[model samples]
Target: MTRDEFMGRLRRGLVGLPTRTAAEIAADYGQHFDDGAADGRTEAEVAEALGDPDRLARELRAEAGARRWDQEQNPAAAAGAIFGLIGLGAIDILILLPIVFPVFGAVIAMLMTGVGVFIAGGFALVVGPFFGGPGGVLAAILFGIGLMGLGLFMIGLMALLTKWLIDATVWYARLHYRVLKPALEPSNNRSQD
Candidate 1:
């Protein structure tokens, strides 16, 4: 597609953005086109350099949604951003989704097992007298208490693991923004040589 087509797609994708923010993005890309032309590049070459418009649109929309969510405290906007990106389509799906889901499943399974163990331990402690004499009952109760403690610890660890997963995903999103930020800038405006 040409620069005009790119801009049109970008504008539509950025509809959720504030008018000024959307216009600024369009202007930056338009400037990118003009600067390329001045440097003797063809429109097609510049558009090609800009990358696929449809995918670009999705990226821009997701980025805009993330920014809005951050600035305005909008949960719906945050959810929209996540859905729009869907692992950013940056990571290899075959590598990412399969690994991520199973890890997630394992964490959840661990959490469930922890809860189950804790419950069973409580039951055993309550029925300690059914085992044998007082010594046996005391031994059974102590074992149950140990199991309950271990289970609670495991559950807490799983909770931390779940939080870490989300934190890691957001880190990827931030990294994507960092990479794209420079690509969108005019060559002359870039910080690197």
Candidate 2:
């Protein structure tokens, strides 16, 4: 392909990627082409020497993916690995009674958690005015009870939501890993088979 056609294709393939990354790649290839042309090569010949657009894009993608994996795999790092995320999901479900009645509990937990958060927010809003009511002592008593229930509900709601999120992410990551592991680990292909 001509340089212009290759650049257009590359740009399309890199859609949604950061502009800086695309610009750097374009600049590098442009420089190489310029250098080669100066040494008595045609644009077509230069592109041919440079290699296939699809192959180059794939190489860059693999490099970027590798860097991402390395960053994630490093222990004592803030960013968690896919496996760690999976385990977190497992723990969230186990702690929040996710195993008892997966479908029913998840739905109920979501509803209850929403109610709890709403009630807690309501407490914050009414706490000030509640102190000035005619039956201030009685108001305070009721407010205290409401606050306690709100706190418990919020805690339970967050636990339930967290469990759902983790489980979904774990399942997604596992499926993705299954598809990618073979292509990525050629040495283990025979064993996997």
Best by lDDT: 1
- Assess the local accuracy of residue 136 in candidate 2 as a C-alpha lDDT between 0 and 100: 71
Question: Roughly what TM-score does model 2 have, to 2 decimal places?
Answer: 0.38
- Model 2: residues >4 Å from true position, as ranges? 72-193
Q: How many pairs in model 2 have backbone atoms within 3 A of each other, for residues 3 or more apart or on separate chains, i.e. clashes? A: 0
- Per-candidate clashes come to 0, 0
Which pairs clash in model 1? none
Residues 82-130, candidate 1, lDDT per residue (tens digit)? 6666734665445677777899899999999999988888877788658
Candidate 2 local lDDT, 2-119, one digit each (tens): 7798777766655544588778888888887789779988788778766667556554543443344445433222123333433323444455454536854565676676676667
- Each candidate structure's TM-score, on Cα atoms with residue i matched to residue i, is 0.53, 0.38
State the displacement of the C-alpha of residue 139, model 1, in Å, after optimal TM-score superposition: 1.3
